[model samples]
Target: MASVLWFRRDLRINDNPLLSEFRQDIVLPVFIFDTQILNKLSKDDKRVSFIFYSVMKLKNDLKAIGLDLAIFYGEPLEVFEKISSICHIDEILACGDNDFYAKSRDEKISQSYKLISFNDAFLLPASYGLKKDGTPYRVFTPFYKSVLPFVEILSQNQYKIKSAKLVDFDYKSIQLESFGFEKADISHIPYIDKPMELLNDFKPYFDMYKDLRDDISKKPYTSGLGIHLRFGTIGIRECIRELILYQKEGIDTSEFIRELIWREFWNMLLIHFPKSEFDNFYAVDIKWENDKDKFHSWCEGKTGVPIIDAAMRELNATGFMHNRLRMIVSSFLTKDLLIDWRWGERYFAMKLLDYEASSNIGSWQWASSTGADGVPYFRVFNPYLQTKKFDKDGVYIKRWVSEYKDIPSGKLYDENYLLMYGDSFYKKPIVVHKVASERFVRAYKDGMIK
Candidate 1:
């Protein structure tokens, strides 16, 4: 039986159910850098580069064991047609994907091939638990608690594929450069990749993740493995094992582990409520300002707000931002700028190397107060107050917005931040917090209160 192991978001070879099971059969490891998706991406996209790099590593590892990767680069359906004509591909196995495009794509392929998907991307199985009435849980905490006992946290060393026996294929891969991937300057950006043996370097910091995860200035203390998780360079199961192992050692790492559960919970929501990708999940009547000029400034980090702009610059520059700041910037964009959450959400979806539609969309809606268990419209974040509370020393602010070193003489722009984000250096904020807050309060009250 010739089974094809179709690699999608789950890119690694270790503890990968599909990849591991394939070694025991006459399997052909295949990765289709589906042009349908890639054609939509920018040339210097790190996510595509990361995917190319990881799959190359997989191909090379397989080659070391006399096996090779059969990469396809067209529409998945057409590629399937070509593969199906040459040899009988009895089964196709892939890690489950919960994104809108992925689900529809999988369905298209599944109609043509006998396919099976495993939970390699998410810790919890995509299956939902129901009440006696058999309905999906609406709230995150209860759904999270209900699924806690069923998690299977597998260790990195659990899988031992002795060899990758060659399954010859008459196929070719488009070189990464030809696909428009170039060398990236990763000097300033913080990334944690296990394939490069980054785990030992960060082991000392994992225990402190609980205390420092939300600290705006010290994001390195939290495992910056979002990219790894996004690309499957680090498996969800492997991360869980590390979490559980540390807990047994009496390390209080619940906060970081809880974040992983959040990722899974969002994935669950994506599968059940795919419409959240574009439309509002709860408040359907809400409207967003679609000002291109305001959005451009926000994207370019000229929002006049120090912390929000700093976070935006960081995301624009490094493809990452601290979690604390992500929420602040998200909220500021939605309420303060009165911009559509989908607009900010789509930009994040494009720039974040760690971008997952499920998490990205879920978080944007959560911050906008249009989704489940989010901040009520009345509870808006004041960026100035938030900076004073979380980044008291101005460490993070200084690092990103280097223009603001000294407060301006006399209170010309902002007496508090005349130097760093002075009126001259940054654009004046599109909307004032007090007015915007009142506007949101009234709008939400009028729409949802009654």
Candidate 2:
């Protein structure tokens, strides 16, 4: 009998629980570029290209053994329909994903096939985070505390690191280009470089991640392993294992470890409250001040506030922004522009290289003061003030918004638009931040009272 190893988000070979225990005679490993997902990605999505490249990396790593990865491009159920029709299969083992699309797809797959899934996406197992009450934890810190012991236990003997062996598989007929996606050129974007380096060997920065993490300009200093986590290029368990090893060596990697815990918090949130994928967690009687024209301006990074514009433009151009900038820009959208969190969420969904539904929705809802277990509604962040604090020199802003020449001239705080090679084309801030803050605050306070 053959056990099919269905690859969804977990794309790597290290520390995968589902693959580790599959002691079957014939094991078939298959990856599907499910159209349910691919159809939604843009034609030139670098994230898709990254995933394809990572999949190829996995296949090459497996090819070191005498096996080839079977890849398919179609609706997942359809892909399975064809696969099960031709290949003799007994049971399907996979590392289940916490995202909406992945869960729905897995449910459909399970209905049609014999499926047993495991949690390889987190340091703490997803099941361990629940209370005696049988509900998932909404607050992050308590959840973190609850799951700490499981993380400790799993850290020991996680991956026994056997030879890079693939459980022999026959590939199915498939072509990625047949679907509407392009090969990665990876030309101008420097962020896409050296992913394996960032994954396997980067350790120094994670030790300092606590102090250096929030700095917008020092972002590349933080090991840039987020895309790795998002795509599962480096297994979550591997990251935690390394973190524990660092701790044993008397290094304080708690901050980096906390970020991983946060990652688990997000996925757990998605699992317990799937409805949060599109809807707000708490009631906000106040209506969103959603202005399309303003949102468009914001999208173009012309919102007139330099930092917000810079952050938005950075995201639009490169599909990434510093985590601090992510919060600042999101706050500007939901609070200052009075746009719905959903609007900003969809925009990030389109643009971010590391976009995950749980984090995106959780962050946006937190900014909008409509999510449980996040920033209080009254705590609105001011982008101009935040820029002055985190990016005092405005170096990050200048990188994306070249028109802010005054900052380069060392007179930006004086407040007149410094000519971008001599023209004032940089957009103006859309609404007065203070005015918007008061509006959002009063409305939210009133909503809470009501």
Candidate 3:
């Protein structure tokens, strides 16, 4: 009896524990184009295109090794049923996904088949990172400290993949058009076949990450490993290994490693409190003044706040946004516009090519001050101050917001100067910063009293 290697988020074969375990067996690799998730996405969704590209790449890699990847487009359960009918599958091996939907899906799958799943995406498993009292951590610092030792030990446990015996099966891939998604233009998307090359390229910048990461106007000072990490193209263990090597070179890798810990921290929170994905983690009443018009403006990058607009436009165009800009734009939506963080989170889920549920939701909540260890509710990011600090030269703003290309750097921070450009050329600021800041604080305070 042969085992089926079910690939979900963990797409790559390198450092994949699930794939490594079934190397000696007649393993048939499989990926289900989950329609339940796909139905919600746009036809030109870059994320869907990226996933399709990754799946295709995985298929070719497996084909070269005399194995075949069975690609199916349907509900995962139905797809598994079809797979069972085609092959005499004894067991299904897959990496455990920590999100609520994934957990529910995996539970149903386990009921039907001999499912052997491992938490291959995160450095430390969800269960291993809890407090001494066995309660889940609400804050990041303690959580990071608690998991550090385990992370160091497990970071060394990298998976070695041996050749698998190819099973005789008619393997086929469902066309992108079959699922109502257009054929992906992989030109703009950074889909790396060998993640190691990307990691190596990022090494030189790792030391400067802490200093220049927040500088939005500059070229990417941080590692652009998010998309690769999201799909498990590169395993977390391998990333940690790279960090270890960097540390040995006397590089201050603490800042970069902290980011990886943050990713794991969010994953742990999702595993422990699944409701945090949709609802506020802490029980607090919120009166969301969700203005549809303002929300649309924010989405289209027409809010007239150069930094906010730039970030939004970048996300709309590339399906990716810088980390600092993500916080800025998110804060603008939730705090400045007084919109619900869920609104921003939903939009990110729709657009971000590197969208991971836990990270997206967690980060949105952090910016909106609704999550555990979130920024204080009173602390709203002033777009003018942020622009002056991060994009002092308006280079980032000029790149995304075309109308602001020739605007003076000093004038970019002036609301009145930006307004002079007019609604015809550049949009006027939707809300006065001073007024909105006061209104948001008052509203939050009133909600707390009620």
The most accurate candidate by lDDT is 3
lDDT of 2 by residue, 15-128 (tens): 666556665657778888877777787898988888787788777765665556889877877877776777666778888777777777789878988888887766565677
Candidate with the larger TM-score of 1 and 3: 3
Better of 2 and 3 by TM-score: 3
Residue range 129-238, candidate 1, lDDT tens digits? 44456676667889878776666433343544544444567756668776566756544434433443444456666677776667876555666678778878777777
Over the full model, what C-alpha lDDT does candidate 3 score relative to the true structure?
A: 0.83
Q: Rate the local accuracy (lDDT) of all candidates.
A: 0.74, 0.73, 0.83
- Please tell me which model should have the higher TM-score, number 1 or number 2: 1
Write the residue-wise lDDT of candidate 3 on 147-226 in tens digits: 87777789989778767786677686678888788975657655366666777777778788898899877678877788
Clash tally, candidates in order = 2, 4, 0
In lDDT terms, how accurate is model 1? 0.74
TM-score, model 3 to reference:
0.95
Residue 49 error, candidate 1, Å: 1.2
Question: What TM-score goes with each of the models?
Answer: 0.90, 0.90, 0.95
Query: Who is ahead in lDDT, 1 or 2?
Result: 1
lDDT value, residue 371 of candidate 3 = 89
Worst 10 residues of 2 by lDDT: 413-422
Among these predictions, the greatest TM-score belongs to: 3
